[model samples]
Target chain A: IAGITQAPTSQILAAGRRMTLRCTQDMRHNAMYWYRQDLGLGLRLIHYSNTAGTTGKGEVPDGYSVSRANTDDFPLTLASAVPSQTSVYFCASSRGTGELFFGEGSRLTVL
Target chain B: GESVGLHLPTLSVQEGDNSIINCAYSNSASDYFIWYKQESGKGPQFIIDIRSNMDKRQGQRVTVLLNKTVKHLSLQIAATQPGDSAVYFCAERATDSWGKFQFGAGTQVVVTP
Candidate 1:
């Protein structure tokens, strides 16, 4: 069903470089979210979009940004990535209610 | 408004034994809860869910219990197997929010032979 698709399954980037993690959902969900999972820590929300044309900041939204131009795509951008940004990034979508569907995840390594 | 465990914990169990995973939530307004299982190199998959009104729910060989008074939630797996080895997470949804969920650090389960 390809519930959710993420690009660049894994990546390695140098500090100060820019990177964007792409997320797409075929479920036509109204809401999408970006989260980073760190070792020994839980998944922290980075950014979220309630619907197309609207976005909201989450707990850990400092080094990242997201855009929702349509119902199917939400991309997270890291402008000048830092070493601390090294973690696994996950994309999720929901009907704007409760349950969520997640992507396989994108592992990012910043050196 | 959202809080999760600061560190991940591991639980080990012998095959065929029952496994219990626990989680705690702080927000009293949170009325919906869910459990997810994540395997190596994979996304978190839904296991079971429970709302505030109910104290317990059961699925195929799995059970979820909710205790609103204590703000604690638990997942019980019967007949643990090697395939059950994974990281389990608990997420709670606050009332009237835009489907926002707060996730716990997660508990890693290791099933031994």
Candidate 2:
């Protein structure tokens, strides 16, 4: 089964440029989340949506925004990319408070 | 204030031997603890989870032990295999936090023949 798919597996962007990372899940889960993984640090929550049309900020939501337009898609956008935003981004989905299923991840590098 | 951390960054075990990974959490209110395995270049997958009310949970060849007394958690894998070579992350969720999991950097496991 195609659990979760993240677009642009890897990307490079110039600082201050706008960018968006796409995420789609076939599980039809009610909740979705975005997290960033950095070296020496654990995965930090960036944003999460409990259901469609609802979004909430996470621990490190600064410089990042996420939207759950429908049950299947939740895209993360960066208004202005910065060097500190360079990291592996992961998308995950879950049903209610159940376990989370994660995507392969999108490696982003800002120069 | 809550934090989850792994004791060792890397662990090497011989094939067929049992391997144990340790984790520590500072949140006494954590209701659930989870272990996730991430293969190279892949997203983290659930291995097992233990609730605070329970001290241990078992799955396939994996066993998760939670010691709330010491705020410690451990994952034991029976008969280590090459497929078990991956990074293992420990996560904790406090009571009232739905999906807000506090994660650790992860421990890398290497199984050798």
**Candidate 1 per-residue lDDT over residues B1-113, each given as its tens digit:** 89774556999999999999999999999999999999989999999999999999999999999999999999999999999999999999888765788999899999999
Q: Name the regions of candidate 1 deviating beyond 4 angstroms.
A: B1-7
TM-score of chain B of 2: 0.92
Worst 10 residues of 1 chain A by lDDT: A35-44
- Model 2 lDDT per residue over B16-106, tens place: 9999999999999998999999998999999999899999999999999999999999999999999999999899989888977899888
Q: Return the lDDT, model 2, position B13.
A: 98
As for candidate 1, its clashing pairs are none
Stretches > 4 Å off in candidate 2:
B1-8
What TM-score against the true fold does each predicted structure earn?
Answer: 0.95, 0.95
